[model samples]
Target: MRAPLLCALLLLAGLQACVQAFYLPGVAPQDFKRKDVIYLKVNKLSSIKNQLPYEYYSLPYCRPEKIVQSAENLGEVLRGDRIENSLYQIQMRVDEQCKVLCRIDALSGAQTKAFKAKIEDDYRVNMILDNLPVAMVKMRKDEKSNSLVKLYERGFPVGFTATTSGGQPEVKFFLHNHLRFTILYHKDEITDLARIVGFEVEPFSVKHTYETPWDKVSPTLNTCNPGRATFVTHDMPPQPVKEGEEVIFTYDVRFVASDIRWASRWDTYLLMIDDQIHWFSIINSVMIVLFLTGMVAMIIVRTLHRDITKYNQLESGEDAQEETGWKLVHGDVFRPPANASLLATFVGTGVQLFGMAMVTMLFALLGFLSPANRGGLMTAMLMMFVFMGLFAGYFSARLYKSFRGEEWKKTTMRTALLFPGVCFGIFFCLNILIWGQKSSGAVPFGTLFALCFLWFGISVPLVFIGSYFGYKKPAPEDPVRTNKIPRQIPDQPWYMNPVFSCLVGGVLPFGAVFIELFFILTSMWLHQFYYLFGFLTLVFIILLVTCAEITIVLCYFQLCSEDYHWWWRAYFTSGSSALYLFAYSAFYFYSKLDITKTVPMLMYFGYMSMISIGFFCLTGTMGFYACYIFVRQIYGAVKID
Candidate 1:
C-alpha cells in the first residue's frame, strides 16, 4: 500500500510538470539585454508625384550589400517624384494604376515633438498630411488640427533598411528629414555627423513606427509590410494607361530614428507578467470544454438509458405496444438518410475527418502543436485523417447492415472515398493556386503526400476492422411495414422549398458576424494584425448555437409540413454556413476594402471559401445528427400506422 501510494504521487508530479511546462512561458531566469530594433524612413511626395501609376513607380530593394554600394548616395533610389515609403521598413508594390497606399506608425515621444515642429513650419507638408493621426497631433500646440482622421491613408511605402551586424554594440538609428530627399544622419553618429552637417541633435528612445501584433515572435516580416501592391488589383482601371495618366494617389512622409534604451526577451516577459494575463487562450479553453462536456454527457446518458430500457422490454415479452421514442421508427431507422447514397458517403468521410479535426485541435490547444510548432498542425491533421477514415468504414458498414443494403463492397468503397475525396479535391486546387504565387505560407508538397499516406496507411486498415465488426452485428428489425406503393412528395411553393428554408435559416447568424468578418478578412488577406482569439472563440460558440438552433427550428417546421426527406436537406439547411461565409467575405471585399479586381480577390476568397466549406460541413453535421436524434425520438415513439 505504501509503495503504490508513492508511485501514484510520483506519476502525478510528472504530469503536473508537463502541464506547467506547456501552459507557461518564461519561468526561468535570463539575462536582460537589448537587441536591434529596425526602423523605416518614408520620404515626402511632391504634388505632381502624388498621382502616378504603380507601373511608373519603382523602389529599389535595399540590403546591406546594396547599402555598401550606394553608401551616402541614397538619392539614387529616391529619384522618383512620388513618396515611395510612407511607413517604415515596408516596401510598396504597384497597383494597376502604379500607385501605393500607406499605413501610419506610432512615433516615439521624442520623434513626436520633432514631427509637430515640422508640421508647423511647413505648409506644403500639411497639404498631404491625411494619414497622420490628427487626434494625437491635435492634443499638442496645433489645437486647430482636425480631430477626425481616417485610419487608412493613401501614400507610398518607401524602402529603408538598418542592421545591427555586430549585435547591439554596432547599432545606430537612422533618421530622415521632412523631404527625405537628403541624408539627415545616423543617430548613433549624430555628434560626428552634426559637426559635418551643422545641426544640433538630441537622443530619444526608438520604437516601432507601428505596432505589429505578432512582432514579439514573428519579427522577420518582409512580405506583409506596407506599400506593397495588392495582388488582386494587378489589372485595375480597365482602360489602357497613357504615359502620364494617374491611377492611384500617393503621399509623402518624413521620419527620423533615435535610440535611448532597450528591452530584451526577458524584459518583455517580465513586462507581460507585470501586466495582466493574455486571456485569449484561457477563456477559449474554458468555454470549449464546458460545451463539449455538456453535449457529450447528454448523448451518453440518454442513449444508454434508452438502449437498456428497450432491451429489457424486448426480453420481458411485454407487448412492445409502449412504443416509446426512437424504437417506434424501427422501420425507418435504417431508411436511407435523405440523399442516402450521397449523404451517406459525404457524412461517412466527414465523421472520419471530424475525429481527426478533434484530435488536432486538442493537441494544438494543449500546446503540443502551438503557433510555435509551425507546421505541426498540418502534420497532425494529416495523420488524424487516416484514423478517421477507419471510423468511416465502420460506420458505413454498420448502417449498410441496418439497411440490408446489398453490394456491400460498393457501399464500403463509396463511404471510404467520397467525402474525403471531395474535400481533398477542393483543398488541392487551392493549394495549387497558393503554390503558383510561391507563397511560403502555403502547405508544402511533402505534407500533402503525408496526408495521402496517412489516409491509406491508418484509415484504410481501421475502416476494414470497423467493417468486420459492423457486419457481425444483427440487423435491426422494423416496427412498421413499408407500403408496396411509394408515397408521392407534394409539390410545395417556392418559399416552402428546402433551398429557401436553408437560405432563411442562415441569415441571422450571418448578420451577427458580418461586421466581425471584415477584421478577420483584413488580417488574412491584407496581412493586417489580429490576435483576438478569445472574442473569436466566443463568436464561434454563438455561431455554433445559432446554426444548430436555426437549422433545427427550420427542420421542425418542414417536418410539420410532412416533408420526411430531411436527410440531405437537414444537412444543407445548416450547411448553408458555407454560402453565408463566402457571401460575407465577398461583402467585406466590396464594402470594406479598396480592392481593384478579380484575381487577388478571387484567390483571397477562394482559400477562405474552402475553409468556410469545411466549417460548414462541421456545423451542418452537428445540426443533422442532433435533429436526426430528435426526430427519431418523438416520431419513433409515436404509434403511427
Candidate 2:
C-alpha cells in the first residue's frame, strides 16, 4: 500500500507539471488576426486611508458590457476574465487631429432615471482616476529602477476655462497635456491596443489677452496622474442639465507605433525577488538545523549510550538490578492514549495535510506552479488535498486499530470531516461578509455548490475506500507490551511539564520560518506580488526538519524523566507555532496595515485563523511521526524477558 501510494503521488505530480508546461507559450510568436471588438474590465476601487474596496460597476450611469457568452462557468468570472464591450460606441481612430469623433446624449429618460436611482443608493461615480483598463502589455525593462513599468492606457486631462464674453459665463475646454501612444503587434496583424510609455502631468495655466478691453484671469488646474496617465473628473463640479439641455465633452486621442510583441505580456507582472533576504533566511534556518542536529546527536551518543552500558553492566554483574529511567516505564510507554480514536483521526488528517503540502511545494519548486498561471496555486492545492483523502483515512484507521479501537466507522468519518469542516465553515462566513460588501472577491453561489460537490463526490468516497482497505488488515504488533494496569506517573519538573515544553519547542520551528513569514504576510495584506517559490520551498523543508528534530529531542527528555504521556505533548510541541503565528498576525495588522474598515479587518483575522489551523496540522503531524519513530527504535532495540 505504501509503495503504491508513493508511486501514485509521484505520477500525479509529474502529470501536473506536464500539463502546466504544455500551457506555457512558445518562444516564437504565432500570427493571428486582431478581433475588432474590445472589452472593458472593472476592478475594486479603494482609498489610501480607509483601504476598503467597493464595487466599481455598481452605478447605472456607466453600464458595463454584460457577459453574453458562456454564463454557466462561475470559475471564469471569479478569475476576472469576464469582459464586456463599452456602452459608448466610439470608433478607434489613429490620427493627430483633435476632432469631434462621437457625441453621446447626456439624457436618455429611462437610463437617466436609473442613474438617479443608483445615485440615491450611494453608488460611486465612474471616475477615470480609479478605473484601470483590462489590457495586458509587455513592458520594456528600465535600468534606472531595475523594474518593469506597466505600459498602461493614457487619458488626457481636461480643464475648463470660463470667461464673460457677452455678460454671461462662457466655459471653454482645454487639453492640459498630450499623450503619445504605441501600437503593438499580435502575430501577423496589428492590435488596436495602444500602449502609453511616457506622460507628463505638471500644473500649468494658459492665459489669453484679447485686443478689446477685457479682464482675464486663469486659475491653475493641477492634473493628477495615477502611474497609468489616467485622469479623474471627480473634482469637477456637477453640471445640472434641465429638460433638453445639451452638454458636450470633447476628448483628444493619440496613437504611436512600437515593435514589441504580445507573446511576452507575462513578463510585465514578474516581480524580482530580493536575493539577500532569501539567502539570510536560508542561513538562519540552516544554523537552527545544525543546532538541532547537535542536540539529537548528544542524546543518542552520550545519554542513550551511558544508560545502555550501565544496564548491561548491572545485568552481567553478580547482583542484577532493575532498569531505571526510560527503561523503567517501558510497560506503560506503549499504552493507548485516552480518547485514542480522536487522536488517531487528528493524526490521520494531519498526515494528509503534510502530504498535500509536500507535494504542492515540490511542484512549485520545479516551476510547475507560477503566478503567470492564474489560479494555479489554489487549484493545485485543492486537488492535491482532495486526492490525499486516502492517506487521511488509511492512517487514521490503522492508528485507531493499533490502539485497540473498535469504532472504525466513526473514526473514519471524523477523519474525513473534522478539520475540513472547520475550514469550510470559516470560509463560508468570510464569503458572506464579502457578499454583503458587494466585492468581486466573493465566490458565487454556483462556485460554492461546485466546491461542495468536489468535497462530497470525490474526496469523501476516496476516504471510505482507504478506510475499508485499512480495516481489512490486522492491527500492528507493538515491541513493548502494554501493561494490563496503568502505571502511576510521577510529578514532573516545571520545564518538563507538557505545556511549558510545548511552548518552548514551538519557538524553534516558528523561528526557522518567521523571516519568510514577513514576506508572505506582506504579499497577502499589502497586495504585493510574491513569486519566490524556490525560497519558500526551501523554508518549508527547513521548518519540517526543525519540527521533527525538536519534537524528537523533547520527547526523549520527557521519557527520560519517566513521563509516559508523550502523545499529546509531541503533537502540541510543534503545533503551538500556530499560536505564535496568530500573535504575529495581530502585531502585523496593527503596525503594517492601514485598513480602518471593520469588514476588511474581520476578514483578515478570519482567513488568518484558517491558515494557522492548517499550519498547526502540518507541523504537528511531522513532530508526532518523528517522536513515534524515535520511541519505537530505542524501545525495540532493548531486549525484554
Candidate 3:
C-alpha cells in the first residue's frame, strides 16, 4: 500500500517537473514573409443538435487537389476531429477579393439532398488557419454602443433556408458561397517577424450574374470579377442549392497587423463574451463550506468534548452500560457493512478518479493543458486514470482486509474491473450508435483495442501487484473488536431513515458545484472555450470539503441515534449527489440545448450517466474516509474494551 502511494507521488512529481522544464508546444506559430502561401485546414462539420461530427469533405463541397490529413492524438480522434487541407488559398500580408476557385454548373440529386439535410440540421463548418479557428462574425445590438456590434460565433453555419417572395412563397435552399476573411497578425518590434494571431470570416451568399459565357477555362462575372471585382456584401442574395442550378465558390483574404502578443492572442477568440455568475458561484460555495465548517466545529468543540468528559467520569463499566446513544454501540460502530466488496471497489476507483481530476486540473491551471494542445487534456486524463490503478488496488485491498475479507484475488479483480467495465460498456454502445449514423464521432476499432489493452494489459497488472502487496500489508488499528453477532439498529424516525438522510446529506455537496457543472457542460456540448481552471480547482476543493464535512455530521448524528450500520450509509450519503446531477442534466437538456435528434438525446443522457456514476465514486470515497476517521478518533478516545 505504501509502495503504490510512493509510486503515485513520484509519478506526479516527475510529470510536474517535465511540464516545467521541457514544455512541448501544441501548435507552434510560424512567421511568414510577404506573399507566402498560408495553408488553410478544415476540421469537421458539427452541429449542436446532433452532436455528431462528420468529416468536412463528406459532403460534395470543394476540396483541395490532395487532401492530406493532419496527425492527431488520441483525444482528437475521440473528439471526432478530422483536420485536413482545404481548397481555399491564402498569402501572407496580401489581400484578395472575389477570386473564383471553381464553378459547378449543376448539382446532383444526391448532392442537393445532402446540402438540404445539413442546412436543416444547422451544421457549422469549422476551419483552421495558423492554429486559430476561423469564426463567423455576426452583428448584435450592444447596450453600451447605441449601434450594432460584431459578435464572433465559433463556427460558421453551412447555409440557411429561404422563401422567395411571390403569390405563393417558393421554398428554396441557399448556400453561403463567398467568404471574406480578416486575419490579424502581430509583428515583432525587434525582428519584424509576423505571426498570425486571429482568424475571422464573414460569410455571404452572392448569386452571380456572369458577363462572359460559360467557358471551361475562364468566365467573367458582372457580380464578381477579379479585374473589376464586386466584393461580397451582407445584403447579397444567397446562391440557391437546387438540382440543375449553378454555384460559384469564391473567397477574399485580407491580413491586418496588430499589437497583441502571440501568447494572449486567444483571449479575444475565447469569449468575444460575463463572469459575475462565476463570482456568485464561488461566493455561494464558500458560504456553504463555511456553514458546514461551523456545524462540524460546534460538534467537535462543544458537543463531542462534553460527551467524552462526562463519559470518562463514569465510575465503572456498570455506569458506562447505563450510558445511551453512541457510547452504547461502540463495539459495533467499526463493523463492516453488507456487501463490503462493492464498497471497497468503488472507494478504490473513486480515489483513482480523484487523483486524475486533481492532477489534470493542476496541469490546466499551470497552462500546460491549453486548448492549443488539441486533445492533450483528455489524453492526460485517460493516462492518469490508467496509471492510478496502482493506488486503486492498494486502497481497496486494505479496505477488503479491514472488512476481514479472504478473497483477495476476487476483490482486487473487482476493484480493477467494476467501474471501468461499466463505463466502457456504455461508451462502446454509444460508439456503435455513432457508427450506425456513419458519423466520424465513432471511436475507431484500433482505438477501442488500445483502450482494452490499457485496461487488461497495463492497468490490470498494476492493480494485481498493488493488491498483492496491500494484502501482505497489515490492516489498520481498531479501537474495539466487532461483536461476533451484529448489533440490532433501533427503529428510526422518517427523517432519520437511511434513504432520507442520504438524500438530504447529498444536497449540500451538489449545491456547492451545480453552477460550475453548468459551465462545464456548456463548454463540452455547446462548442465554447473553458479556461478558468483556477475557479474549477477552487470549486473542486470546496466540493470535497462539503462532501467530507456533511458526511461526518450525518454519521455523528447516526451514531448518536445508536445506528451502527454507517459503512454503507456514509458511501450512499455522499454518492446520492449523483442523483441530483442526473436530474440537473435532464433539466439542462430540455432548457439549455436545441438538440432535437433522438441519437443526440440518448447520447446526452448516456454521457451524463457515466459522469454521474464517476462522480458518485469520487464523492462517496471522500465521505467514507471522512466518516472512517471520525469513527476511529471518537471510538479510540472513549473507554471501550
Best by TM-score: 3
Q: Give Cα distance to truth, residue 81, candidate 2, Å.
A: 7.4
Ranking by TM-score: 3, 2, 1
Q: lDDT tens string, model 3, 152-260? A: 6888888888777978998788888888899999987687679988889888888977865776576777787667756667777769888888888888888888887
Q: In model 2, which regions exceed 4 Å deviation?
A: 1-55, 59-65, 68-268, 312-323
Give me the candidate number with maximum lDDT: 3
TM-score of each: 0.50, 0.74, 0.95
**Which 10 residues in a row give candidate 1 its minimum summed lDDT?**
194-203
As a TM-score, model 1 comes out at 0.50
The candidate 2 region of ten consecutive residues with least summed lDDT is 124-133
lDDT for each residue of candidate 1 in 476-523, tens digit (9 for 90 to 100)? 554455444444445666787877888776665565455556566655
Tens digits of lDDT, candidate 2, 105-165: 4455653443333333222221221012222233557667898765432222222233448
lDDT of 3: 0.85
**Candidate 3, clashing residue pairs?**
none
- For candidate 3, report its TM-score: 0.95
Q: Global lDDT of each model?
A: 0.44, 0.63, 0.85
